[model samples]
Target: MRAEFFIKSFCRIENGQVMFNGNTIFTTESEIFSNFSKETYRHFEISYPKFFKMDNLSKLAFLAAEIILKNENLDADKNNIALVFSNRASSLDTDRKHQKSIENSGSIFPSPAVFVYTLPNICLGEISIRHRLYSENSFFIFEKFNAEHLQLYAHNLLRTKKAEKVLCGWVEFDGDDYKAFLYLVEKNAEIPHTVQKIESLYYNE
Candidate 1:
């Protein structure tokens, strides 16, 4: 028999606001992602110094994951929890910054710090380090939020016993625009981890 999976909880971040399980958690007047992220970090009193140095992609994903993960009793399953993330912009936001450093004809200096996050998966690393999740992790780039793929992937991971729970969502950031929808998948919850359900929750206002 196949094992069933459920969405235990979820969080969203966009337009200078943050929401967890459909409730408003934080709001800010700062439109710039950089400023808004910092405001949220302080608001939540998250004590991670490396958060400030992360690129926008990492910051956004990390915050959404942090909120959704913190609420759940993940202490026992921390090591067994897997991460599955998708994004439309990939690492373009940070890629642009890295490009600028080398693009300048007058000064051709590439920063190792900026260059480190050229790949989209770096955000996964940030989340993993923050929550100490040491399990399967994957980042996919899609033209849009592919709920079906995410649902299927989580199902396989859970049914196969590869993960006790899965943290999956779409987190996109480009220039000054950004959006994140992170949810935790486990064997128990009110809602089934279906593609339709994932789509509805992602679009839920």
Candidate 2:
């Protein structure tokens, strides 16, 4: 059997804040980092001016992806990697906006551009396109994320040699509340295969 790279390590939204390595990143939603210092906030502002402009769902997905990328410590210089993201809301905000145009406004016929983002999986496409990842890509949504299903699909991908690495997770945005936690799982023996263990990493609160 070919050697599968281990998960190596992972990170989380520690203590309900956007924290990594014990330092808080400016996060507005959780209120955990409501006391972030001026210097820290400035750094985030400079590094991600566009981040603040994104809608809640986009922001959540982007932040989750960033956390995964940072923790993986892998080079993203190439476009061969794959990103498989599954979410519950499925661009509901985007749909709401576009639907208003179709339902309420007669003159502003809905644009196809806006319609494309309505699918639940388009968020995966957005992330992949942003990172130039063109490999195996998919987006799925169940009534809730099925841990057994996710594990089986992940294992099948690695066993079939589809992706060198995969980024998968649950990201949901409903109104002001959002929860996103992603994992970088590859073919590895050290990782846990049981659904209970994997599912525990998400939704700590």
Candidate 3:
């Protein structure tokens, strides 16, 4: 395959700073969690909506994705974009609640509202719907954060031409840490089609 795109652009979090095009965009006190709602805090360190909302992940993903898209100035609906994400705790919060409902013994009916968020993939559904990105989507879970999984899945999508572009990374919210990072990769002039070595990029030590 030929290199179709060179990274004319890049953004990253490093050295306690978010560097974009060599400029700092935003930073916050680590104590920002002090101001979140109680339920948000329980599920995600004081997030909005207080209680578990099946849509919460979508909301967060949308904001994060939109931030990247706006900074890169890419239009979501126009691009044939895909979203691939992996997380350590896939809907563990909702799973706990659903089990509680059944375990109540007396109350045999699980609330359909709470039961819905138990799936690991619904977050991706939420994001795709919000962005109107009716393209490829996937969600994976691992014991811990693994950049190798993220990179390989993304590279395979591009390699197989399942999508011309992809938005991929990690997003997990529980207790106090609501961390997310995403990159938009598109077929272009700089990067050519070849073996995408995720191990070297993520596991070089």
Q: What value of lDDT does candidate 3 attain over all alpha carbons?
A: 0.57
Give the winner by lDDT: 2 or 3: 2
Question: On residues 1-205, what C-alpha lDDT tens digit does candidate 3 reach at each position?
Answer: 5554322333333222333434555444344333322222343233334233543444445445645655544465575678887778777756776778888855656588777777868877766665567779988887876766665676788789888777776666554455555556666645332225222222221
lDDT score for candidate 2 against the true structure? 0.60
**Which candidate number maximizes TM-score?**
1
The stretch of ten residues in a row with the least summed lDDT in candidate 3 is 196-205
Task: Estimate, for each residue in 59-144, the C-alpha lDDT of model 1 and write its tens digit.
Answer: 99999998987886667444688999999889998888888988873455568899899999999999888778888999999999
Computed on alpha carbons, the lDDT of every model, listed in order, comes to: 0.90, 0.60, 0.57
RMSD of each: 2.1, 4.8, 6.1
The better-scoring model by lDDT among 1 and 3 is: 1
The best candidate by lDDT is: 1
Instruction: Pick out the ten consecutive residues of candidate 1 with the lowest summed lDDT.
Output: 101-110
* Model 2 residue 179 CA deviation in Å: 1.1
Model 1 segments more than 4 A misplaced: 1-3, 76-78, 105-109
lDDT of 2 at 189: 42
lDDT of model 2, residue 2: 44
Q: Tens-digit lDDT track for model 2 on 1-205?
A: 5434444334344224565323455444334332222233354443555544445566556665765564455556754556666767677877787778787756565667666666666667656655667778777776787767766776677778787777766777654455666677765646564477567666442
Error of 1 at 145 (Å): 0.7
Q: Which lDDT value does model 1 have at 110?
A: 62
